[model samples]
Target: MIGIDLGKIFKGNLKEAVNVVNRVKEEHRSYLYSGIGRASILLFKDDFEKSVAFIEKIPPSYRDFCYQGIFYETVMHFHKYSPINNGWDSEWDIAKVIELLEKVDEKYKSSSCFGIGRGIMSFEFYYAESRRYLFSDLVWKSGKALEGIEASLNGYCFQGIGVEYGRKLLNYFFAQDYFQPEQGYSLDNRFFSEPLNKEINRTLKGDKTLKGDDRENYYEGIKMAVLENFKDEKVRNYILNRIRERERSSGN
Candidate 1:
């Protein structure tokens, strides 16, 4: 709905669209503002900086939401290239987005970063064609590894990954190719454990004080993401072992 309106109102006239959104009541502008952010990208598809400048023109109250949309679209753009053959091509997008994210106010940075994580992993599953391709090879290969993102935003990013991962696991009908029992492709332990383990490891190492309930909450989200879909003992146990190793190291 917001997208439809944006497409009609934003037909090469950013100021006209901005003026219209500015007049909309504050109570109903969040999604609309985010849509405007997405529109900025689409309108300035040839120039990333122009998109950023357009987002800056939005009111401060809603600018972060626009930034969140930008984060998502930027991530999608970054993943378009094949990780194996086009590794160098995508790094610039990540680096530039991180620089853009750093400019977001602290209050909004968490949400924006979370959007990036969710946006990236959403495609990870979207690109999966079968059980052998159950998870994103790009993610597993560290092609879109978010090493450059701020450390404090790690929890939100993990939560974003958890949300998409959990949702994907539940799509038994829609994603039968990846979830069906008879696919004969063993669900590799790395597919489930490696990314979660890697992020948790980085989080703890970067901030050891991120322990107890605060840390466990993120781990629990990761656990719940898979617990329902993975009933096999080996798969469940493997995830537990990986998490437990980090849990013990963190003195949890």
Candidate 2:
């Protein structure tokens, strides 16, 4: 797996890393591997323009698998380098980000892409609206949608969605316990919360009780629900511990 030590690269001056990434592109290679690496370099540099440019050049066939990896690395880099209290700093140009996302949507279409597309769409939606949407609307609304797509996609989709829900749930918990309800801390609460519960219900509907490894999906769904309902550090640690436990058990 191709990877970069983002922590090491973005430790000091972020601009220096951007320069390094820009310099590397002079090599003139445009393979999927090269695109992935270059995209990482641009993201670390916080050069959204360069990153989007590089990513847009990649063909659609390679994009389904590759784009998610690139986006995950970008988010991870931002989380480490420019985080706010519970979220990343929105320093990059939103218009540029939106434009890139539109390109991503067009290139990948909606069919045969499944989790990766949903994952990108989720993050983009969160970034655009400051809240998460229901998994069904995010993953299943498009024409010619994939069936059983959630099970087939990478665990990252579930994990990432869990993290976002966790963040929002913490916000809701904090607001109810301390802040004013009129403040709208759980902005878009209904959109995410309702479907989250519905997913758990659907998973266990009829005779399909969550069992064996299938239990993980149910747990992930529950974890997201809990994340939406709590925000304390204790709750955060507990949820994270549960996720780690599941990962270890899965041997992934």
Candidate 3:
């Protein structure tokens, strides 16, 4: 319900718009997520340092939200391969993003939790906990796989994708639902703001006919595939899952 001064921002007066957010935040510091989001808008519009400054003004606990990422372009750059952004410049100071996330992780570990001051932090952490996964060194791969999913879902033919890939896609959606149910329900809906429930429904049920031990085996196979391919270096489960799956299949 924060009334952002879009008029000031539309006039190219970012400072004024930011000041309005600051004043609003002062009165309602408990709900300062909107204010922090405003700063990110500026950051998206090429207002760099000041955006960071506004973010810095937010309580240290909430500063982690700042690191949650600002621009959709930045999010897509890491989370999707061929993302279509409205005004994303390739040369933007992506380092600043790393710097912010690093600072939040290294410096603000003990600060108050975002939304905790107002009793809403757990809701955010419960879903879309992207803050926990961010890093400066970039521990993830470009999501070219999203294209494969979209194509398979929208494509007329099954394209001979196996049970392993099918389970991987479904597992991914389940995890997303656990984090952000809305996004988990439909990638195109959450990310692209498109009405795409038909494709999403089709994808979710793409493997519905498989059952029993066959289904279990397929799920296990996809789990192994994801760990071996997309897992971060720090995840101990990657090595363990591979070894365990190998032993389980070999009857060792």
Candidate 4:
């Protein structure tokens, strides 16, 4: 996984950082099919240039079967919206993000496999950008949208790119407090996490009566429990670990 240091960005100008993210959002308004995850990693990182350069070295034709358009779109969207300078601008930051994405594309094409490396790279970039605007109001809005998408995507893909991407999104949302205990808003943690847990329990208990919001609430409660209880590990990691253990025991 590509790790990002968000604490570094918080020491700088937070307002300006959020404004830049908002700019990117406005530029890529057309491509949004669902909510985008907001994370500190997306906002700040000193080694952004190095990260971009490394990913850019990859060819453009590479295909990320796991995330498909997600990798490309995320980079392009951020690049298109990022500010050239810390000041103001009507133009897009396409040059920088595109350059890096091109490298990602190349690397994927060379490997002939959609490795997690590309996804990690994209995530690092996103996190760095997001960190800069962590305290901004935009984070709340974007974070919620991201959580919604994640919950919606769950159970659709068991393994492979879809699952990986879903996990990333979940982690990002968790980090940003999108799943805050009892926080009201579209990004409320209950929407996805709680529902999944309920469904899992229902399946285990052989309870068919639990459906819709009831099942969703059960999952939400589980998510809240995990978040509240697990302070050291990330929410995604906790969930994935359980899934892995279950699969192993079940011989799946």
Best by TM-score: 1
Residue-level lDDT for 220 in candidate 4 = 39
lDDT of 1 by residue, 155-195 (tens): 67655555555545445332433334454324454443444
Could you estimate the TM-score for every candidate? 0.52, 0.30, 0.27, 0.24
Residues forming the 10-long window of minimal summed lDDT in candidate 1: 84-93
Give each model's whole-structure lDDT: 0.58, 0.39, 0.33, 0.33
Candidate 1 structure lDDT: 0.58
Q: Write candidate 3's Cα lDDT for 109-143 as tens digits.
A: 22211111111111112222343321111101111
**Which TM-score value belongs to model 3?**
0.27
Superposition TM-score, candidate 2 onto the true structure: 0.30
| Candidate 2 or 1, higher TM-score | 1
Write candidate 2's Cα lDDT for 20-52 as tens digits.
Answer: 444545332222233354345455476655554
How much is 246 displaced in model 3, in angstroms? 21
Q: Model 3 segments beyond 4 Å from truth?
A: 1-35, 69-73, 76-105, 108-252
* Two-way lDDT contest, 1 vs 4, winner: 1
Q: Which ten residues in a row have the lowest lDDT in candidate 4?
A: 30-39
Error of 3 at 139 (Å): 16
Candidate 4: give its CA RMSD in angstroms: 16.5
The pairs that clash in candidate 3 are 128-179
